[model samples]
Target: MPLHKIIHINETTTAYFWYITEDVTSLFRAVSLKDTSLFRLEGMKSEEHQRGFLAVRMLLQHLGYTDYDLSYDEAGKPHLSDGKHISISHSHEFSCICISNKLMGIDLEKLKEKTLKIAPRFMEVKHLENLTTSEQIEKATVIWGVKESIFKIKNEKGISFPEHIFEDEFDLKDGKCTAKLHFNNQIENFQIHFYNVEAYIFVCAFPNK
Candidate 1:
């Protein structure tokens, strides 16, 4: 598929999802990559990762960009030549990219039982109470995505998920939530939007401006 969906998150932010039904060779031939990206793609250990990487470029092309316009900083945060903020995430057979005029972060996570099993390690287990096992898995996956999105927004060192990011309680049906990042002697507030796509949870975080 070309693009699974496009979410106009705000006046200046958008999220693009790519359903990776095509094989790696098909994706490789569809997008033009710079030498460095080609090198990185060649070194990738898994076909899935290569497909994810190439799918992102396909997304860029859709947005009027090419591989030459993307770069990374010392902290491995992706940037654009035109100075917009970008965040990329892919899992399993789906890849996603978010672009915004403001500082933002996005995360895509597959719903799985493992996220629920390890919920206590990163989130407060009390929130999982009163929910069925399946609900628990879905909620835990969203919470993990919340933390991950915030982490990408900050992209600072020593920001532990459990210790630094705290997700406020919200109903699973709400499909939205708030979170706080208590790090670097400051507190930051974030607004979160999440949705379920197939077996995956897509999350987007925008810091309070």
Candidate 2:
């Protein structure tokens, strides 16, 4: 299940998904990673983490990119050798990346009961009302991803999900929504697109133009 799907979000951005079905050794052998990436891979404490890291490289290769073309900033945001933007995320069994000419952030979250349980911590509790248990889990997962994607896009300190990011009213079936970030003395808006992929919810956020 390599390169599971490619989503053309717009003319300038695309999202790629990779289902990690290969062993760590096999994945490592398939991609040519830079020395820094190799060092980071070795330091990862879990095999699942290593596989997710390698799967990202495989995705880059699929897009005609290699580890050499990707770099991370001091804030841990990814960058391309070119001026294009990039965001990466991985959940339990899936890893994904989104590349764009515009600033963007993406997150992949596996559906879980824990996210629903902790919904009040990061989101408005009223939004969860009038929904079934399963819908509550899915909706909370999406809201979490929304904040995560926005945080990644800003990559600045002091951005708290509960205190700063707010998801406006939206229905699950809409598959898209809007959010606002009230932080750093400025308010910015975002357009969010989200959908279920396998057992995970994929969310992409782009700052309002």
Please name the candidate that would achieve the greatest TM-score relative to the true structure.
Answer: 2
Flag clash pairs in model 1: none
Candidate 1 residue-wise lDDT, 1-209, digit = tens = 78889888889998999999999989888999999899999999998899899999999998899999999998999999999999999999889999999988999999999899899999999889999999999999999999999999899999999999999999989989999999989999999999888899999999997
How much is 127 displaced in model 2, in angstroms?
0.7
Please report the TM-score between candidate 1 and the true structure: 0.97
lDDT of 2 at 179: 100
Question: lDDT at 40 for candidate 2?
Answer: 100
lDDT tens digits, residues 1-209, model 2? 67998999889999999999999999988999889999999999999999999999999999999999999999999999988999999988899999999999999999999999899999998988999999999999999999999999999999999999999999999999999999978999999999899899999999997
**Model 2, position 116: C-alpha lDDT score:** 91
lDDT of each: 0.93, 0.95
| TM-score of candidate 2 against the unseen true structure | 0.98
Q: Candidate 2: worst 10 consecutive residues by lDDT?
A: 1-10
TM-score of each: 0.97, 0.98
